[model samples]
Every structure is written in C-alpha cells, then in structure tokens.
Target: MLPPIPVLADYGISPTHGFLPDVLPLTRLPDPYYNKWEAIAANLQALILSKRLRGVVDRLPVLDTIGLEHDAEWRRAYSLLSFMAHGYIWSGDSPSDRLPPSIAVPLLKISEHLEVPPVATYAAVCLWNFKPLFMDEDIDNLENLATLSTFTGAIDESWFYLVSVAMEARGAPIIPLMLTAIAAAREADAATVTRCLHTFAERLDDLTTLLQRMHESCDPKIFYDRIRPFLAGSKNMADAGLPHGVIYEDGSGKEEYRQYSGGSNAQSSLIQFFDIVLGIEHRPTGEKRGRPQEQGEGHAPAPKHNFLLEMRKYMPGPHARFLNHVQSVANIREFVEEHRDDRPLCIAYDACLAMLRALRDKHIAIVTRYIVLPSKEVRTRSRSRSPEAVRRKINLATASRQQPPGIALDTRGDGKKDSLKGTGGTALISFLKQARDETGEPAVEAWAHRFMSRVIRTEGQGDFFAGKPEEGAGLQVASQTEEAVIPGLAASWTVDDDVGGICYY
Candidate 1:
C-alpha cells in the first residue's frame, strides 16, 4: 500500500476529511486578549479611514494585550499584526519593507506560536481570520467566510481569501491521488498510473472551473484599488511609489527597508503543492544580466532567486518540506513519456497539461479585464489632460460603498474608467504578468514536446526514487533532476523590461 498519505493536519484543515465548522477552531481566544485584539483592530481601522495609518502603527503596544498563548490568541494577534503591518507598510505614498518592533516583534512571536510565517501570509489573512456564519456550517461557502479584519472591509478581500479556502477544500483529495500515483509508478503498474493520471486531469479541470468563479462576486475595480493594496509587499514595487522606503513611526528615527515581496497567490502553499506534485517547472519572469549559470544536477538550471520561488521560504516548515518531497517523487511525466507507445497514457498526460494551461489562460483573461483594461483606461484618461494634471487617487472614504453584486467589471472595448491604476503606479501589471507568464503557452508547449517526442530506448533500470522513504518500503519511484528543481523548456523571463518608469510625486 502507498505510504499513508502524509498527515495534512498541520495545515489547519485536514486533507483527509470534510471541513466541519467545529472540526477546526479557527476563531479568536476568549477573555481579555480577545477584546484586546478587537480594540486593536478598531483602532487600526480608524487610522486607515483617516489616512493617518502611516508612521503611527509603531505606537500601538499590540503584543502587550496577549493574555494567553493559545492558538486562538495567536490567531487574534496575527489578525491584528496583519492589519497594522499592511497599514504601516502600504498606507503611505509608498510601501515599507522594515517593520517596526511594535508590529514586527509581536508578529514574529505570534507567528512562531501559530507555526506560520511572520509576514502577512495566507495563514495570517485567510486561514486564521475566517469564521463560519453558523457554528455548525462548513467554511467552504463564500458567505460563511466572515473575515475578522482590521483594514477596509470589502468583498474583494473576502473573495480573494475565500478562493484559497475553496481551493484548499476542493484540492484536499488530490493529495491522496498524487500519493497513489507515486505508488503506482513505483510498482511500474502502467495501467494504474494511467488511471491516476486521468483522475488527476479531471480534478485539475474542476479546479480551473472553480477558479473562473472569482469574477462571480469579486468586482475588478474594488479588487484592484482597495483589496490589492493590502496584499502588496515592498519588493519590486518601486513603480507603486517607494523608490527608497517609508520611515517607521518608532522614535529611533532610522531609515528601514527590507527587500520582501508581499502576499499573493504566488505565496499560496496549496498551489505550490500542486506545482511540486505535477513536476511543473516555473522559470523566472524577470530578466537576468549574465549568461545562464552552469547546469546543476539532472540538467536543471542553477537555482536563481525568483520572487515566486523565494516565497517558499515563507511557507510553514512542514508544508514546505511536503512540497520538497512531492517534487522528489515527481514521475508522471517521465512515466508517461517512457510509455509513449501507449497512446492512452500520452493522451491523458497531454490532457492534464491542457487543463493546467487553460487555468493560466483563464487567469490571463481575468487580468486583461480586471487589471490591464482598467489600467489602460486610466492611462488614456491621464494622457488626455495636461502634463501637470494630477493623477486620480483611491478614495478610501468611498471604499465601503458596495458595487453591484455578481457583476464583473465591464470588459467592453469602450474606454471607460475602472479605477485600477495604470502600469506606472500599481504593481498589479507586473504581478499579473508574472503569474500569466508562469502559465503561458510556452511552458505547456515544452511539456507537449516531452510528451509527444520519441522516448529514449535505453534498456537500463535506474534508481528512480531519489532517497529512501521512512516507511522502509524501498519502492523506487522515478528520479527527478534534483530535490526541487523542475526544469522548463525554452521560455523567456522578460517579455519586455523597458515598459515604464517609477511613478513618484
């Protein structure tokens, strides 16, 4: 039997079971600190509304309020820090990298206690911050995700977090599916492998379909202007306004900045799990200066500091290792290629890649409307005015106003304002382009070549599984390039580097 699917309990929700409300206690702690975190949230919101959130977060003794060290308290503390952190970092004309002690110290402590990254991670914002509308109801419902937040309460934030929640719930089954696929590959059971591949394809298709529903309730304008700001980090965001850095409110009066990317789906562990399991090799989307580094093991290119890859450092330790292990046992593509003679296996693998490609294509289309079009409209409107004309700004006072529910931003060719900043002001374009590039046709096309190309006819048995599993099964899966290096074919990181200059006043 396949080594018992690794326990996913540490991930807050177990992959083995349905997410009944009480099954996971993702709520605030009771008593003094409970009220304390609430008070902190209220104050943070007050500051945000007044546009005075900048340089003032450090004064809040956010950590001193913790009465106990329980998970609930940690959750509460995380919620507070997320609000304060984002506000302190992004409320200014530009984002800040250095976090003040009031926010950073307690945040680091609480995140350690909660076993998550110190930054505004998926765990801090989504996993730990949501509660079901009813005590007995499942949290998978979008309506059930009552976000206990400190910033502007918008449906866009709820929708972004819920999308991940829904994805985790739906993606739970795939963990076992992938594990079984590995076992089948070890047994050299071509039939079993093919069956697993077909199942994986169907699940991926379902996921792609689920992702398309993001537009159903989440308005693009609200998302770009209101929700996206809270999730942005200071790294690669010069265009968004911090050419240098924002000063901290701390009395130390020291300029502080750190190069760190912000919270995005790129940092989602669940998605990374899929990439690892599927052997999807993601190349960098930013340009490099020198010749490619010498090839590492398995013809894998030398590791580079890809912002997406770097986010792995922020994942929960167990989850990060889980990704590494899954990557170690990646065998579906190799197995399918080895059996190219079997048309069914080849077709099944191709179909899976197609679904993955389709998922990226759908995201690109969403970006085109949600980010690109509105941005282009903004740029066009700004251009029509005099060179000295002041660019339009996000009106936080009107942030609470709700858009018409269930309607996506109009994508008609007509040039209408949709509220998203143009490529010059927001990091949305770069982030979206990076995401789109990862899922672009080139990556899938490379896989297509490997799937359709003639299989090498070497009649030699090689040690497939890289390392011995703890189970003592001694079952050899297939050898991947290295631990985590999944190689992609011909793909360029930069489509065009010289797009625009940083937007600063």
Candidate 2:
C-alpha cells in the first residue's frame, strides 16, 4: 500500500503556526537551576558588546539536561545555549576554537534531544527566538514581532531576523493548504487541486511582498558589518579563521573539531515545504543541468551532496522528517504534468513555480544589496587605505583579532574575488542564481519555461529574468544594480563559475 499522507500534527507542526512552535516559545526555562542559561541569553548583547561573553561562558558550570522537562523547555534551552554558543565563539577578537564544557556538554545533549545540530541554527536564532510585542496582537504582524536575542543589539539585527519570523508566520497557512493540494492530487480531483494551487500561488505572492519589506527596517550596512559576523558558521570559514572548525570540549580532556554551517534561511522548513509540495528538485550546487540520462549514464554521477538536502540536517528533527514524508507523497507536479491538456491546472501549477521563482529572484536582489554592495564597498575602501590603517580598523571592530567570518577584504583584480560564501558555506551568487533558475525548470507552460530560463542582460546592470520594463508589470525583473555590480553577472561569467552564494540569515 502507498504511505499515508503526512499530518502536520504528527511531526509537531502546527496548522496555525506552521513550523513555528504550536505554543508560544517559552520566555524562560521553568526550572530555576537553568537560570544561568537564561541570564546569559538575557544579557547576551551586553556580554558580547563588552567582549566578556566568552570569559563568562567559560566560567559557567556544566549544566545537566535533566531539568528540561517538556518540549518547549527543551526548545527554550536549545535557543538559549545556541545564542550563547555563537556569541561565545564570535564576540571575542578571534573566534573561539574551543567551546568549553559548560556550553558544549549540555548543548550536545539538548541538540540531540531536539534533533538539530549543536550549533546555532535557523530554528535557534529565528524560529524559537522571537516574542510578540503585544500580548493580544497577531504574531504574524511584522511590526508586532521582536527578536529575543541578538549579538549587536542593533535594530538592524532584529529587523534582519524578524523578517524571516514574519515570513514564517505569514506563510504558515500555506502549509495545510499545500498539504490539501497534495491530498487532492492523490485523489485526482482536478478542481480541488486547481483551487489549492491558485490559492498557493496567491499566498506565495504575499510571501514575496513580505520578503521585499526586508528593507523597510533592516539597513544593509549595519546588517553586513555588525550583524552578519555573529551568524557565521565554522565550515568553509578558513579565510576568516577556524580552519579546523570548532572543538566542543567535553571536560574529559578530550577534544574533537566539529564544523557546522551557520543559521540560514535555507534551514527554514517553510521554504523547503514549498519546493517539495511543488515537486521542485534542487541539484547539488554547480552540478550540470540536464534531463535524466538514458538507461546507462554512469550510475547517476554518484549522488553528490546537495546543499539544499544538507540544509535539512540543520532543521528541527521532526520538521526534517515531515519534509521527508512529504517528499514521498508529493504528486502535484506529476499530476499537472500528466494533465497538460487541462489549461487551468497547468496554469495554476506554473503560476506556483513563477511565484516561487520570483520569491528567489527577490532574495537574490536583497543579497545583492545587503552583501554584494557592502563587500564591494569594503574592497574599494581597503585599496585606498594603508595596511596599518586597515589593521587599526579591524582591531577596533574585532578587538585586535582577525577579520570576522563572512566579511573578508581582498583587493584582487577587478575586485571580483569569490570571498563571500553563504553562512551554509555555498558560493553566494552562483548558488542562488542556480537555485532560482532551477525553480523555473519544472514550469508546465512554455512561456514560463522560457521566461524563467532565459537570462537577459541590461545596460551595464547585470543579467536578469528576460522581460521588458513596464509599470506594474507582473513579471518585471527585480534586480537592483544601479550602483553595485552583481558578481558573476558579467558577460564573461560562465555556468561553471564558482562565484559564491551569500548567507541568507
């Protein structure tokens, strides 16, 4: 028999809140013994600003996980420790290579219990880290949300995080809606499936608007310099340091280096859910694009590690399982493909893909503003400054340690260095462009297939979705390239270019 359709509740998912905790995140752990963790989290900004967070964390006693009694409590504890861990690693002049037992021991246990990695994750920093500003107000309101923790205590930091929080909350309804569409597809009820897909497309447009609102509060400069550093993970971070990742000490005189990607939106189960429900497949970054090979294609290239699949490891355990189960039963894309003669079904399905691709397109535009422009400005500034002056600035920013991860200053030829990688350690621009391009690949309509697949060049700006500019045009390309050059968009850049994807916080 075919597997049963997945229920949101079975995996601790919420109909109202989606992947967010069904109940509000606990403000504090219930046990007084855990107050130490709470105190650190509450004072995290101050501790990080003072550059004394590591010392305080190193002096902490190794706490036991026995006091975490419920799932909410476990989640709260995980968020608390994850914040403290990231702060401890990054607040210092040099990133801490070793995590003391006080943070490492309990963190490992809690992460295992939560089925997430022992590093700061999207769930840690964004999912479980927010508090509604007003008790009676809806959490989905962007203005009503605030982050409980931040490294810089800057409004930009909070805005950067709350954008994702708001997106998750606003996008929550699509969860059950798409699951219903999945069920409708299974039943081969074309009308219900079409209705669901139409609604899905509309909701995705709402998400795109929410994504665009990112600039309303979060300033790109502050986000790039002050906030981005705290979100860097140890993996592929050799340029900023931590070549061996981090060593989580267990107080037994034993040490092991562990590397993990930083908190990323790619870890957000909501985004992945959209892709899975639509049956959108993402290959490993930089993998050649093509149809599946005929009977013998060298065994499918050994099933290379896909970054999107790797991001699943960073999600909460139950959420990860939910995606896996959803993947097993996803049928909307297949149903749409089989019923190509049905114009409404095909249009609805392709509309969903178009909106998703548009959402990614907006993401690319935002990354260009927040990361690409700022890095380019830094590189430009560095070229004019003497080495001693740059060193002094670095010292002032990092308390005399090396430059923080995700903000490297390389003044190479044409300032086209591939210095920036996503917090997940993938090529920043290339990976995003490929992912955005991939989202358009399964389009059911010939027009959509061409619209999403074609890359058009503008006058000195960069490549964008092929289209003519018109006021209020539904499919107008949304790239922002007046003052900054989008890396890898030049005519010389190629499909195999290893240009990076920016860290989507």
> What TM-score, computed on C-alpha atoms, does each candidate reach?
0.69, 0.85
TM-score: which candidate is best? 2
Q: Model 1 off-target regions past 4 Å?
A: 1-13, 17-25, 42-46, 52-59, 62-68, 92-100, 112-117, 135-138, 246-256, 286-304, 385-505
Pick out the ten consecutive residues of candidate 2 with the lowest summed lDDT: 488-497
TM-score of 1: 0.69
Please, what are the lDDT tens digits per residue for candidate 2 over residues 1-505? 5678888889999998999998888888888998888888888889888888988987899999988888989989988888888888877766788889999999999999999999888999889989998979988889899888777788888888888888899899999998788778778899999999899899899989998998998887787678777777777555445677899997777677888887778899999888888877677667777874331111112223677788889999999999888877777877887899999999998999999999988887786677666656665676676666666432112221334333343446786544344434455556777788888888888998999899855432422655444554423333222222222210011112222234432
Candidate 1, poorest ten consecutive residues by summed lDDT: 484-493
Candidate achieving the largest lDDT: 2
Residue pairs with colliding backbones in model 2 are 427-500, 427-501, 428-500, 428-501, 428-502, 429-500, 429-501
